[model samples]
Target chain A: MIETEHLQKKYGDLVAVKDLSFKVESGQIWGLLGPNAAGKTTTMRILTGFLPATSGKAAVAGYDVFEQAEEVKKEIGYLPETVPLYPEMTVEAYLSFVAEIKQVPKTRKKAAIDRAIEISGLAAVRKRLIKNISRGYRQRLGLAQALIHNPKVIILDEPTIGLDPAQIVEIRQLIKSLRGEHTVLLSTHILAEVTQVCDGVVIINEGQLMSAGRLDELTSAYREKDGVYLRLKKIDNEILNLFRQLPGIDGAAQEGEEIRLEWDRNTDRREEVIKFCLDKQLGLLEMRSLALTIEELYLRIVSGGVEQ
Target chain B: MKAIRSIIKKEVLSYFSSPIAYIVIFTFLLLSGFFFYSLVSWFNSVSVQLAQNPYYYQQININQMVFSPFFNNLSIVLLLMLPLLSMRLFSEEKKMGTEELLFTSPLSVTQIITGKYLACLLILLIMLVLSAIPAALTFIYGNPELVPFLLGYLGLFLLGAAFLGIGIFWSSITENQIVSAVLTFGTLLLFWVLSWVGYSAHGLWQSVLNYLSFFEHFDSLTKGIFDTTDLVYYLSFAFFGLFLTHSVIQSRRWR
Candidate 1:
């Protein structure tokens, strides 16, 4: 439901978002992954019509963000990084005000507010002033304001920034429950969140698009690093050379009695390695598949250059 | 229209939710009431003494004895009070970071500004309405002239609205409510003094500065004179301030 082409934003001599382009499909949970100062917020702001792009074009829900901003604003719910709350207002009052401003029909305003409060898990604190609530509840209240009108797309920026672990899990579960019902475009510095909750991932660094695709497709490209680790009772150059010559092995690294073999995800070098060990009479102590995590892929793409 | 109404409703709710509204209204009423009564009693003593004397033959009415000078003092009260009413219009939003909510909402810059402008105007209207309590009490002593009394209040309302417009613009330019309040008072004081400064100049320059003074138009209107030029000046002053507010808000969205 979101697309951009050469979307660039600059503040005088500083380029905040540069040559960024990505697309998010409807009803999909897409995670925008980047480090601090990586232009994720700028891109999201442009898509939400809060900030105009310095150049290029962006559209949300099929409307040009700059030209048809009001319509785009109507179709998306945005939870900014800071939560942007009126601390003096009660939770219910804030949600209802959001409902009114979002133009929810008068007949459905109460129901809409109720639905958002229920979804954000803010029923108990509905009567409490926003400033009196805990940080976790405040974050949820921010979510409630965004969801009050039930916009087609939900955009959240670092939704779990300051929350404790349990609160983070609760909020993550809440986000996960939105899958396939509403299109979600969320940005976070949490990499494991991308793997656990996102249907697709878009990795960006330094205001540039680094890598983006389905989660499995993204990790599949790094299977060469997915290998088997082994520790043997004995070590020799001849045995190391023999193991490196195995048919399924892509490469081998030996440090004293320990050996690690690298291969693609589809390769099964375990059986071959065991047979060779038996044949050579070398005692094998440990062997297991070392899976490559999205974090590693992220690090590789960020520090190892964008070629991957 | 719905957006504007929602904005005004939220602003009004917010205004009353804080002690600032009560304090502003209370100060305005107390100050105006004090001045209104003292001026009325002073006028009463003067008119009484004049009636007893044979040397004074100039005609004295309630409009001349009470409304004219009381309204001028009312303008001074407004100068002290209207800034407090409008100081938080945009500055608090900016300081609290709630402008993100306002700027990103479906409402346009014009809608947001118009809504806020009307909310501040409503506060001034409340103060004006409450000031009428003192005005109505004047009926206990003498018959107040209808046209001049009405026109004087009209002048105060217009002048207060213009000052509120300027206050909102100043609030938009900075995130400090104190700065906004002080800057508004400073600017209004500058306008107040411009007419005094016109005394030293000669010919067209002096006349032009006097015409440009905010109180000059207000003074003319309080005199029961119906001049479209005064209306034009007040309306344009308010419109220009609001237009600048809109520009400040719009420019904020870019960087």
Candidate 2:
């Protein structure tokens, strides 16, 4: 539904997006994960046909952003970083105006506005002026306007920024409900948001693509070794040595009260370790497999520890 | 066409929803009414004196004594007031970040510009119509030439359109409404004073400057002379302002 190839955008001597390439399949939720100033907003603006790229190409819904901007615009909905709204307009009036500009047919305009209002949970405050609404409702109204036209592709820049915890959860749930219906490309610096709401992620830093893939695939691909963490009571050097001497147990180290055991990727030594702990009279409190999380993966990629 | 209509509707609604439209219209009507009252009183006094002498009575035409100066004063009032109307057309969008909504939508820049221009023009039209209430009173008391009175209004509308064009262009180039209003006032004031400056020049310089001055073109129209040159000048000046607005907006997208 959305694709970009070597999409570079330069503001005079400063490069905002550098040769960035990514693709989003139909009906899939993909997160553009990056820190601030990572060119996420610039990429989105180019895709939405708001800004002309200095070089390269981007297409949304099979329409080239540069050559066929009107068509592309008709096929996509965009919510910019700051929700653009007229404070003087009522919520319903604002949505109606967006539907009109988005070219919703007159016969169905009312229905469209109602559906957007319903989806964004704006039914109660539809008649209230925008300036009088709270911040959370304003954000929802922004989303409602973007969804007013029911475009094939929806691009949101920092959709959850500046929201309270409850509002953030509500917005994430709203986005998750959109899965398999509309192809969503939302950018955010929050790692947990991507992990919770997106099927895949394209991580970038400093205007460069660091990594891109499904959540599980990325975690496994970045894993260096198979390991398990065990918390056992009454731990001692003698028992630690005995555990390290076991077959397939390549390394064992004590991290405070817990024991970290490393082994070959294909080995399952957890059972053996549990048995060993029982025999040694060390009370095993808890045991779990050690795997890289999306948070760690994001941190590793953004901190320049890994190159992809 | 539908897109332009929608934008126009929204612009008009926004103008009315705020206090700006009512304030501008009220102030314009009050000022124009005051001018009409003072001018008519002076004309009545002069005509009474001239009634004693047939020769002086011939010199006391109401069009020259009242309507011409009335139209000129309204033009200056428009010059001051039209900037307030156009200052927020584009600059407020930029300030409130609604330019993103406008630019990202399917509407072209031309459609957006036309919608806003016509909306402001509509307000100017409404003000002109209301100011005629006092002018219409002239018909009740004295016989004023109909053609020059209407032509004077045409000239004011054209002049207002030109001022709006310049104001919209300046609004497009900045995000600050005050800056847009000030720049528009400065540019319009320069054009208003150009003929005064031209009086000191000689030969070709004099003709060129006078021709370029908006006041010179407006002067002939209020005097009841209909010339295509003045029409073309105001229309082309308006077109030139809109053209510059288009270029500035389009260029900013690239930057």
Candidate 3:
């Protein structure tokens, strides 16, 4: 539903977004993962037709963003980083205004507002002025405004930046519920958010694309070797040295009573280690493979371990 | 058209929902009323003095002595007050980060500008209509020429429109309301004083300065003379201001 090719945006001498390219399929939740100043917001603004790319192309819902901005705008809902709102307006009135500006059909405007209010859990504060609402409520109101139009694509910039733990969980659940219905492209620096809510991720750093793929595919593709974590009842330096001296075992480190063993990919040294432990009467309590979490993968990619 | 209407409705609602609309209207009415009262009293005293001499009485006319200066005083009040009406038109949106919402919407820059311009015009219309209450009192007591009185109001509305145009343009260029208001007032004050400087200069400089001065065109309209030149001047001045605002906002997207 959204695509960009060689999309570059430069503010005078500074390039905010370099030759970046990514695609999001229909009804798929894709997270644009990057640290701050990684061109995430700039990319969203260009895709939403809010800013013109200095060079390259972007399209949303099969319409060229620059050539058919009005059509693209009508087909997408955008929530900026700051959640632009009028403090004087009531929540319902604000939503109604958004619906009108989004060009919702007059006959269905009320229904649309009600649905948004219901979805964002804003019914209780519907009549309250925006300035009087709490921060979490204001955040929900921002999401409600973006969803009020029921557009094909929803682009959110830092949707959960300043929320409490409970509010963050509620927002994450709300976004997860949007799966299979709306094509969501939300940007965030939080790695866990992507693992929890997104089907795929496009990670960028310093205004360049570092990696992009499904979560499982990215984890496996970036996994370089196999690691087995072994917890033994009686682990000592002699046992760790013997394990290190074993063939096919690349490295071994003893952690208190546990031994973490590393080997070449596609090798199983657990049998050899077990035999050696049995010969020495070392008690083997537990053994498990160490899988790389998204947090580690994100840190690796963002810290320049992998660049694309 | 619907987009423009939505913007206008929202802006008008915003104006009324806050204390801005009430304060501006009340202050405008009070100041205009004060000017009218003092101008009328001064006119009444002078007329009473001239009543004893038939020659002086023949030269005295209510429209000439009262409503013309009344419109001029109203223009000064508008010059001061219209900036307050327009300072927040685009500045508040920028300051509050709502410009992103507006720019990302399907509405064009022209539509947004026109809607806001028309909304401010509506408020100006209301202010003028209410100020007319004091002017209408003149009809009850004396026989004033109605055409000149109405023309004076036309001049004030045109002047206010021109001022709002400048104010909106300045608002678009800055995110600070105070800065916008000051820039608008400073620009309007320069235009206001241009006529005074024109009276002292000679030849080409004088005519050029006089022609460029908004006060000169507005002064002609206040005298009940509806020249197309003056009409075109006010309209074009307003159009030029809006055009500048459009260019500034459009260029911002590129930056």
Candidate 4:
């Protein structure tokens, strides 16, 4: 639904986005993950046709962003980094206005507004002024604004920036509900939101693309080479030495009662280790494959490598 | 059409929902009303004195006195007030970050500009209507010729609209509403008084400055002369102002 080809954007001496290339498959929930000033919002603005790239190309819904901005805009609904809203308007009025600007047909405008209000859980405050609403409601209103026309592609920039935990969960749940129905490209510094809601992530830092892939693939790819962690009831210097000598185990480290076993990637070591442990009558308390958290993975990806 | 209408509707609604619209309109009406009363009082004094003089040799044209002072005062009022109406059109959107919503929507830049320009023009239209209460009262008290009066009102509309276009352009280039308002005032004042500069110069320089003076062109219309040149000048000036505004807005996309 979205693609950028070596996209670059510069503000005089500062480059906001540089040689960014990524593709969001149709109906996929893609997270644009980066810390502050990572060009996430810049990339989104370019894709939404608000800002033209200094060089290269971007397309959303098969429409070129620069060449066919209006078509691209019609296909994508964007919620900017700040929830751009008319605070003086009531919730219902705001949504209705968004519907009109989004080109929802006059006949179905009411229905569209209702659906957005319903989806964003804004029914009770429908007639309340936006300025009087809480931050959570305002965030929901921003989501509703983006959803008013039911565009195929929805780009949300830092949608949950100032929300509480509950509100963040609600917003994440709302984004989850959009999966498979809309191509959602959302940017956030919150790794938790990305881990919980995004199917894939495009990680960037310093205006350059660092990594882009499925969440699982990227996480495991960046997972430390710890191999596996094990807590055994029966552990000693001799057993640790034995583990080091095992067929699949490349090395072993025992810290008192706990043990970390490193092994070759190709081997099925769990069953072998289990059989060996059974033969040796060793007490195996717990064994699990180790992986890095999304935060750690993102930090490593963004900090450790030169962007490709 | 629908896009522009949506923008216009949003803009007009915002204007009413906020106190700024009422404040601006009230101030304009109050000021225009005061000017109207003072002009009428002076005109009435002159007419009554002339009527008492049975041997008066010179004719006191009530129509000329009625329109010239009224419209001239109105032109100054519009020069002062129209900027307030146009100041918020683009500057507020920029300041509040709502320009993102406008620019990212399917609406083109032209739609946004035209919508805002139309909304500002509508506010100016309302101010004109409110200012006309004094003139409407004149019709009830005495007979005032309609054609020249109507033509004078048209001139005010054109002059106000052209100033609004300039104001819109100025507003687009800045995010501070007060700054936009003050700059608009300065620019319009320059054009309103540019003919004074023509007084010190000679030949082409004088004519050039005079031609650029909005007051010089509007004065003809106020005198009941509907020259195509004046009409074309205002229209083209307004058009060029909008064109520059479009360029400014469009250029921001690159930055």
Candidate 5:
């Protein structure tokens, strides 16, 4: 579990993280969605106890980041935006070192390292120096270091960056497997990754929380006011005018042979419109409801507003 | 403490894995031997009486021809060698962004700094050990005083520790290891040559500057006297460097 209240971090004239507040519950994956310079990395660093917040309080795993940093650090494993690795060290050696520093029990250190290497799909390159490995392997090695101690909360920043599509899918599956075992919070600009892997999304922009909720919830909340798209077979303009004259049917637009109906949200006229169409015997070719997408909702929130 | 030990082992292992440790030891041994040989040549040319009191004469002989010149030359070598060992300790981590890993770990700042200091001390210890061969060779033709050799070696090790402390601190303040190396060497050279100016000054300035002289305390060690005050001075200097280094790391998180 993690929470921050009115957290602020300012660097001279520029505010890195504003007075932002959010909470992440146990057994859920929270995606921190933000573009570059959105204070995502800054927030992660503060929560991991690497940097101090300018004001307010943050706690990870019930430990205060500023006051009880050691306890907080022990509870959270952080993979920074740029995975800090010793290139000269072998994958196994680096993981072993991370295990030692993270204070994994002596008896379980090797086992933990092996499990981390396995989960990151680094078994084959365990003995090879990190510098000799490809970038994809290097990224996996960084993930392995973060997972070596199996901390309760795993914070990954752009975990899927620079990987091939297949590697990205493997990493996404790997992160998905960590859902209930650890409270996972990952930051990325990749919207698809969030939709696929995270249970909840927190959108941040310019050091402020733009939107935070479930994926479907955001789309539903931002759905169009009142509209139904319909394609009718050989419908005359007189019938269309009659439908438009009906109460609640504020307007209608034609696209090729299809018709789209727009109505006021205050009334429902779908049944009446259907009855009228049936009575007129105008055949309905195709009909479907429309709703905004999560991507659209996210863009709306981040870029000022969504227009219908 | 566990964190410190882990860091020390890793750093030492890294040194041995590379050619750094061997190169530093070889260079130290080779230079000390050259200085010792030069001292023997000077003694023979001057026809200094050595049969009656080989050990005392050897001390006197070394004082006139070896100690100052050797320390001066050795100081230059140390100034060059020590930075290479300490420069990468923090700067490399900073450059590679691994400082995030260490900073986010449960280890305290004190533990991190002490770990690095201990690692640098280990490298200096190896250099001192290899330099002992030249001291042992002195016993081949003269009755060498083991006490003075031990004292002088301790002095060199402590001096190296102090320089290393400075070097590590400098390294932590920058991401450029080359800049760290240059700054560390410059600082050590300043400390190493200050004694000459102190000895040349007049009146109260002499006393005040003498107290600041790094070489004066070390010279006492070469004279077979392990002065507690000098030991305390070196320890305090080393502690000061570590303290500054810890603060530098702490402040870096803000930046």
Candidate 6:
């Protein structure tokens, strides 16, 4: 479990994170969605006890990050954006060192290291120097080090930044598997990753908390204007005008072969329009539902001046 | 204590895992060994021929050949080698982004600093121990005073520790290791020259300024005097540097 109350981090005249209050419950993947320079890393650093908040408080596993940072650290593992690693160290050596520093029990350190390596899919590169491995493997090594301690919470900042698509999927799946074992706070600018992996999404922008809710809630909330596309074989201009003049029809736009109709927010006029077309002896081919994506909602929240 | 030991062990292992420790120790032995043998041989030839002139030109032997030459050369060796050893103490972590990893771990700032300091001291100890071979060889041919040698080494180790602390603090303030090394070398050069500059001052002011010099106390150590004041002075210097390092790291968290 992790929580922040009005968390603020300011460096002189610049504010990096402001009033970011959120709680992450156990066995849930909480996605922190924000563009670059949106204070995601700053928030993660504060919660991980690497940086101090300018005001307010951060807590991890019931321990205050400021007052009891050591205890907080004991309960959490953090993978910074760059995935800090020693290039000269072998994967096993690096993980073992992380275990030692994380205070993993001596008797269980080996098992912990092996389990992390397996989870990160780094067993093949366990004996190689980190510098010799590819970037994807290095990222996995970073994840392995963080997970070696089996902390109650794991905070990953941009876990998949430079990897190719396949590696990204593998890492995403690895992170997905951690859902039930640890409370995960994953931050990224990638919208689709949140939809695929995270249970809840916390959208932030320009160092401000924008919105926080379930993934479906964000998508459904953004599904405000349900427009239907209709492709007809033949229709007279008078018939088109009459259909457009329907009381429920908010607006209409026509392409060469297809016509798109817009209704008042969430209003469905598809059935009426279809019946009208049938009554007028106009042929109909296709109809479908269009949903707004998380990206559109993110842009709306940031640009529409909706302050959270 | 466990955290401190873990950090210390990791730091030491990091040194051996690379070639840094070997390079530093090798260069230390090469430079100090060459200077030691060359000076002892030159002094041996002069002392043998000019037995009566030994006490006649007492200033020349003690100031040039015996004390000043060796201590000055040893200080230069330390000046060159310490930055190489200490420049990576915190700067590399800052550059690699591992400082976040270390700071966010369940270790106190004191534990981290002390571990790093102990690792640096261990490296200094290794260099000092190896340099002892040439110091012992000096006695094989000449009647060099063992006490002065011991005191000089103690002073050098303490001075190196203090320099390391300063270098580590400098490393913590920035992510540039080259800049850290240059700044450390520049500051140490200033400290090295301050004692000679103190020699030019007049009256009570000269004596007071001399007391402030790094080598003023160090010179007494190389003359076979184990002054407690010199020990306290070096200890304070090292402690102050370490304290400043701790403060810099803690302040960085807020910034």
Best model per TM-score: 2
TM-score of each: 0.93, 0.97, 0.95, 0.96, 0.90, 0.89
> What DockQ was computed for model 5?
0.70
Off by over 4 Å in 4: A223-226, A234-236, A254-257, A305-308, B55-58
Task: Look at candidate 5 and tell me the lDDT of residue B8.
Answer: 93
lDDT of 6 by residue, A1-308 (tens): 88889998998989999899988888899999888999999899989998889998888889999998889999998999988898878888888888988999899999999899888999899999888999999998888888889988999999999999999999999999999889999999888898889999888887888888887877777666777777888645765687679888877777667777778765777789889878877788776555667777788876764443
Give the candidate number with the greatest DockQ.
2
Model 2 TM-score, all chains together: 0.97
Model 2 spans with C-alpha error above 4 angstroms: A266-282
Error of 6 at B211 (Å): 2.1
DockQ of each: 0.71, 0.89, 0.81, 0.80, 0.70, 0.67
**Local error of candidate 1 at A154, Å?**
1.2
lDDT of 1 by residue, A136-255 (tens): 999998888888888889999999899999999999999998888889999998988888899998888889999888888887775565678888897778878888888878888885
How many backbone clashes can be found in candidate 1? 0
Assess the local accuracy of residue B75 in candidate 5 as a C-alpha lDDT between 0 and 100: 56
lDDT of 2 at A261: 89
- For candidate 3, write residues A1-308 as lDDT tens digits: 99999999999999899999989999999999998899999999999998999999899999999999999999998999999999999999999999988999999999999999999999999999999999999999999989999989999999999999999999999999888889999999888999999999999888899998888888877777778889888777888888889899988997666788988877767788778878977788888886779998998898878654
Tens digits of per-residue lDDT for model 5, A1-308:
88999999988889999988988899899999988999999999889998888998998999889999999999888999898888778888888888999999889999999899889999899999888999889888888888889899999999999999999998999899999989999999988899899998888899998877777777766665666777777767886787788777878778667777877654566777778778878787676664565677788888978532
Instruction: Report i-RMS for every model.
Output: 1.3, 0.7, 0.9, 0.9, 1.4, 1.1
Tens digits of lDDT, candidate 3, B1-255:
998999899999999999999999999999999989999999999999999999999999988888889899999999999999999999999999898898888888999999999999999999999999988989999999888888889999999999999999999999999999999999999998998999999999999999989889988788888888988888899999999999999999888
Model 1 has a DockQ score of 0.71
Comparing 2 with 3 on TM-score, the higher-scoring candidate is 2
Q: Which candidate model has the greater lDDT, 4 or 5?
A: 4
* Window of ten residues with lowest summed lDDT in model 6 chain A: A299-308
Summed backbone clashes in each candidate are 0, 0, 0, 0, 0, 0
lDDT (0-100) at residue A125 of candidate 6? 91
Q: Tens digit of lDDT per residue, candidate 6, span B1-255?
A: 887888888888889888988999999899988887788778777766777676754544433475557776887799899988898899999999998889888878888899998998998998988888767765776566666777788889988987887888888888998999999888777877777877898888787777767777777777777888888888887898889999999887767
- Indicate the TM-score of model 5: 0.90
Query: For this target, which candidate reaches the highest lDDT against the unseen true structure?
Result: 2
Q: lDDT by residue for model 1 over B189-223, one digit each (tens)? A: 99888889888888999998888788988887778
The list of candidate 3 runs beyond 4 A from truth reads A237-249, A266-287
List fnat, each candidate. Answer: 0.72, 0.90, 0.88, 0.84, 0.83, 0.81
Candidate 5's residue-wise lDDT over B27-112, tens digit each? 77787788767876876665456556767654555443555455556656776798888988899888898989998998888898
